[model samples]
Target: MAQLGIIGHKGRMGQALQQAIADAGHAIAGGVDAGDDAAQLADNCDVLIDFSAPAALEGNLHAAVGAGVPLVIGTTGLTQAHHTAIDNAARVVPILQTGNTSLGVTLLAHLVREAATRLGPDWDIEIVEMHHRMKVDAPSGTAILLGEAAAEGRGIELAAHRESGRDGHTGAREKGAIGFAALRGGTVAGDHSVIFAGNEERITLSHLAENRMIFANGAVKAAAWLIGKQPGRYTMAQVLGL
Candidate 1:
């Protein structure tokens, strides 16, 4: 069994993760939340799992590296600086990061990419996602990742033609543009669907997360998998053998 330290111990995801680890027969060495110091927690565990906010990511990575414990990061909203920090940390300890930890969602992303590539530019791609009202970010990190997969499939840059919600007096959808839509209400775990519309038919690929436990389970699995990996960066796709 893997000895795990969970960051964001007070949050919903953190609590879920703790339960999932226990149910899987693993032991939690310690947990650190909002005001707790992550570096101290890292010292007591073989692996650190982060389900915290973007603000805490850098500190958690620093702590993981300092303690020589591999890390599994599920925090989203990462910026360029965070990416840089992750790269630096990977030089010292293994790290696995993913916007959505659900194994089904990762597989859905792969299929979306393949469909986008085979369908050609004639098909218009659009991504729609919905999450709980408490979600802080628009177009959630998972949506952006799905968009990136579609862009890669079409051999186009994601930044070049990304479009979000519009108001009045908008023009027709531009060629090669990928549209994104977000909806928040109730306590929906997550729902993402990619629509590919062409002149003849349409293809819709979707993934619905019914419970938060899927993510929690995936994170624990990732932490266990990172136990002996060499110093480097990894993704959920790699973890799931995609």
Candidate 2:
């Protein structure tokens, strides 16, 4: 069995991952929280899984590279600079980064892409997502992931054609734009729905997360798949062979 290490051992996801690691029959090399020595933990593990805050990403990446171990990053709310860092680190070690690690979400993304391609530009795409009240980021990363899939299928750039946080006095919806809406309340793990509206018809795709274990299990599976690989970036789709 592979020995795994966790970068964020105090959070909800981290706790779930601990159980998942055991369920998968993998050994826990160690775990590190905010002030812990991440480099030391990385050096002792066969693979590193990070569900930590975005602010701690650089140090985690450095630790993974320094130890020559593969890493799986499931942390959300990352910016462009963080992505650039991941890309740089990926050149030296195998790295898998994703907004949501659930296998169901990965399949959902594939279906969204297919539907968007067949529907064409006549259909307006809108994504809605809801999460637990404690979630800090708006629009949820999974919503953005679905939006990116739709944009890819339609051969458009999500950055240029994205819309969100619409309040009063918002003009008409732009053609070929992907819109997003976020809801936060109660203890919802996650809920995502993508609506494609067209003349006299509409199509919707959705996925609901009941708890944190789905993500944890998927992350463990992805981490296992990441071991013994050449230096490169990877994805949940690759793990599922989608």
Candidate 3:
């Protein structure tokens, strides 16, 4: 069994991951909580699983690399600078990153892209997502991933077509625009829906997360898969063989 070290041990997701790993017959070598030093835990574990915030990701990743451990990162809200750092780190160790780790969500993203390709520009794409109140990011990383898939299907860049949060005096929905909406509420696990609106009918592709363990399970699976992988960056799509 793999010995895992968890970053962000005090947080909800971190605790959930700890329990999930133990339930899966894996061992927690150590962990770092809100105010603890994650590097110390990394030094003692076989692999590191991170579900920390954007602010903590760099340090956590650096610790894993310094400790010579593969990493599975489930943290979201990372900036472009963070992406660059992750790419650089992958040169030294295997790394897997995903916005949403539920297998169903990953499949939904794939199917959404396929639908976008088949439906063409005539159908307008809109993504609506909701998460728990404590989540800090707006227009979640998962939303961006789904949007990227739609943009890829249409042979366009996501930055050129993203329309987040409509304000007063907004004009008509531009052709090929991918709209995004976010909602935060009490104790909601997660929800995402991709809406395709056409002249005749509308189709909605959606996924609901009932438990956080789905993500924890995916992270564990990713860590296991990364055990002997070549130094590179990977994603849930690669993990699920999509």
Q: TM-score per candidate, in order?
A: 0.97, 0.99, 0.96
Error of 2 at 173 (Å): 0.7
The 0-to-1 C-alpha lDDT of every candidate, in the order given, reads: 0.92, 0.95, 0.89
Clashing pairs in 3: none
Query: How good is model 2 by TM-score?
Result: 0.99
Distance (Å) between predicted and true CA of 238, model 3?
1.3
Best lDDT among the predictions, by candidate number: 2
What are the per-residue Cα lDDT tens digits for candidate 1 across 108-160? 88998899899999999999999999998989888988998999999888989
Which residue runs of candidate 2 sit more than 4 Å off their true CA positions?
none
Local accuracy of candidate 2 as per-residue lDDT tens digits, 79-106: 9999999999999999999999999999
Give candidate 2's error at residue 119 in angstroms.
0.8
Alpha-carbon shift of residue 77 in model 3 (angstroms):
1.0
Best by TM-score: 2
